[model samples]
Target: MAAELMDGKLLAQEMKEELKAQVEELKSKGITPGLGVILVGDNPASKSYVTSKEKACERIGIFSDDTRLPDTITEEELLSHVDRMNRDDKIHGILVQLPLPKHIDEDKIINAISPDKDVDGFHPVSVGRMVLGQETFLPCTPHGCLKLLERYDVETEGAEVVVIGRSNIVGKPVANLLMRKDKPGNSTVTVCHTRTKKEDLLTHTKKADIIIVASGFPNTLTADMVKDGVVVIDVGINRVEDASRERGYRLIGDADFDSLKEKCSKITPVPGGVGPMTITMLLFNTVQSARNRLSK
Candidate 1:
């Protein structure tokens, strides 16, 4: 039998409904949660992502501000924008879209956002707080992955979870989350990256009860590499050639879903899987930030 679908789209819709209600409550209290997105270049992918974020905010009754700058924008100018958002009382959350131009320092821009308003959770402060398991804003993608596991009722406590990819955003933070001593956490976590030997990758992944692949390469995880009855979460979003599609390409995950689904107990599809949850978590974080500011 095929594995059960994780259904991130459905879960995201449910979470959005909760956020919508919370937003209504906040509005009744005279606080409107606001998210500010700064897009520094003309990268098509970045633009599309930002557009999606804006629509999500509108759907959930949160206010959104979009700041678009040219590719030639200087680091100083970018910092200035971030400073403005930081001082804006109405803006509870600030997001600087990633893959900034080569001349700009990504870290500098990320650190510029106030920790309280760093809804993307990319700042060093947020990373440190998350490592300590504090109540700081969690990274959206990894947090969404955890939410997927919880919504699906997948066993995580004491389970061996092998996460492929070691980037600061998804892999590392996710490993930290799973290892935390919490209900949705407490899994024995092992993280693998490019330098890891093939044998080592297969060794850990094959024995894992849960596997999360976010390495960004399409079809990186093969069916044989995973053990039967495992729960697989493919976080990678890669665009590959597809002549049939209108866009001439399609989004795909790192795992070979067709083969892996047959052997796994549960799996998440690429387009509808972690993608929707990421945006939902952003709204969730923005709401939390607004609440924090209001309480202060």
Candidate 2:
């Protein structure tokens, strides 16, 4: 039997509907969830991502305050914008797009955002809180992955899970999340990076009941590397040239999707999979921040 396709686009739409209702409820309580977005450069990919996020905010009725700064802006100027947003009572969440100009210190910019409004969940305080399993905003992509598993009714508790890649963004955080004593967690996780010995990597993968590959390279996890009935989440999105497509390239994930689908019990596809959930979760975190503000 072919694997059950985990349609992230469908799930994201469903989640947006839920969040829209939540936003309306917040509005009734005299609080409109607001997000502050700062784009520091003209990088095309960053611009596209920012646009998508802003559109999502609109659809969900979250107020968005967007700032576009030239790449030539000084680091101090960037920090000042973050600080201004930090003090803005209406702005419940602050998001500074990553990969700023080379001159700016990315770490310093990330640190400047108040942890309470750090909806991106990249601040050191948020990361530490997450590591300690305290309630905090999670990195959107990894949080989206967990939502997929939970919604699909995947049995994660005590299951053997192998995560490929070690980037702070997806790999490390997701691994930590899976081992927590919570729903969609309590799984034994093994992370394989470029440095992991091939034999050891194979050993862990072959025994895993679930594999989440985000190595950012094509075919990093092949069908042969997993056991029967495994669930695979392919987080890597890479562009590969293909003359057959209109765009001259196709999007693919880290796993060998064509083959893995035949052998796995469930899998998420590339463009339609984890991609959609990321933005949805970002909206989620922003709304959550607004909800938190009501308690104060």
Candidate 3:
């Protein structure tokens, strides 16, 4: 049988419904969870992402504060905006949309966001806490990947899992996350990066019961690399040229979905798979931040 499609759109909707109820409860206590998003430059993709987050916030009764700046904004000026958001009592979570203008220092900007309000979980403090297995805001994409595994009932306990890619965003955090002694964790994980030899990568992946690919390239995993009965969660979203499509391009995952589907027991599709989960998890962190604020 072909792999059972792990439907992320359906899962995200379910999560949003839960969040909606939580928001109603918070409102009764006169506390509204708020999210502040800072978008730099006019990148169409970034704008689309920010818009989706805003819509999601609206749906869940979370307040949205958006700041759209030009590519010419200075690093200092951008940091000022981040600082302002940090002090906004109503804003429980602050997210600086990534890939800021080339001139801006990403590390400095991420470090500027208060760890308590770092909903994106890119802040150095948050990343450190995650590495130490402490309670911190988990990065949205990685958290989403973990949640997908849990909701689908894929057993990770003692599972030999291979993670392709080692970037901070999806790969590094996820590799560390899955190795922790937690319900969705407790797996032996091997992370393959650019330095890993191709033969070695396939060797590890073939032995894996779960394969998570975040390498930003197409065909990073094929049937030959992963064995049958493996669970595949693809995090890459690369656009390839397509003549038939209206946009002249189509989105694709790292794995050769068509070829790998027949071999894997479960798989997540691009666009609808990890993408929606990422946004939903961001909302999750936002709500959690508000909840944490009350406890403090």
Candidate 4:
């Protein structure tokens, strides 16, 4: 069977168009949705990701307050910045770019952001609400994964699903989301982690009707490990050496696309798949945060 692409780029564009219209409507109501981003250091990949988010905010008519800080900034200084944004009436959402300098306490920074403006959904409060299936900002990557499956009309109810990761950001949330008693959920879910035995991991994967891979490494899902006709959503974004490319490197997903494409019913690609969806959902959550304030 020739596998069909999930086409996250296309779906993300559609979602952005819808959000743009919402932004216009909110503007007419004399409200401008705003997002404040804290970017520390100058990591190239993080900078690129932040730029993409800024462009997305512009496209959707959301106001962006992009703040750049030095790598030497103290954790207390970062928290002070977050505190100021938390009190800013114009800023409805706050996002701290990940992989902050090693000297900084990541959890303390994440905890400093108010739950109401925590668009990245890493705050303990947001995570707790999500675990209880309450209204809250969902983490962009996992939420984007669900949105992709929903938009593509994939069957999740009663389906056997294997998630190959355990990270709090993507794996834990997505697993909880898939097993919820709701559409695009209700799947019999199994999550494989680092401690999982190779044989056990393959056994769970081979029987799953859908496999969501966020293993953070390439080649985690091989063709032989899964059964034919399984649906695959690869969330991994790994950089590997590629002399043939102009940049001397290439981006790849967890699943072996070339070998698995012919076997799976549907699959998402590396550069254009989950990556785009993740950023798009960040925009979605920011918009939602702004809208929530209007009703208050």
Q: Which pairs, if any, clash in model 2?
A: none
lDDT of 1: 0.94
Off by over 4 Å in 3: none
lDDT by residue (tens digit), candidate 4, 33-54 = 9999999999998999899899
Q: Candidate 2: misplaced stretches above 4 Å?
A: none
Candidate 4 contains a number of clashing pairs equal to 0
* TM-score of candidate 3 relative to the true fold: 0.98
Q: For each candidate, what is the lDDT?
A: 0.94, 0.95, 0.93, 0.93
Clashing pairs in 3: none
Predicted candidate 3 versus true structure: per-residue lDDT over 130-226, tens digit per residue: 9998999999999999999999999999999999999989899999999999879999999998899988997899999999999999999999888
TM-score, every prediction: 0.98, 0.99, 0.98, 0.99
In model 3, what lDDT does residue 235 have?
A: 95
Model 4 worst lDDT window (10 residues): 179-188
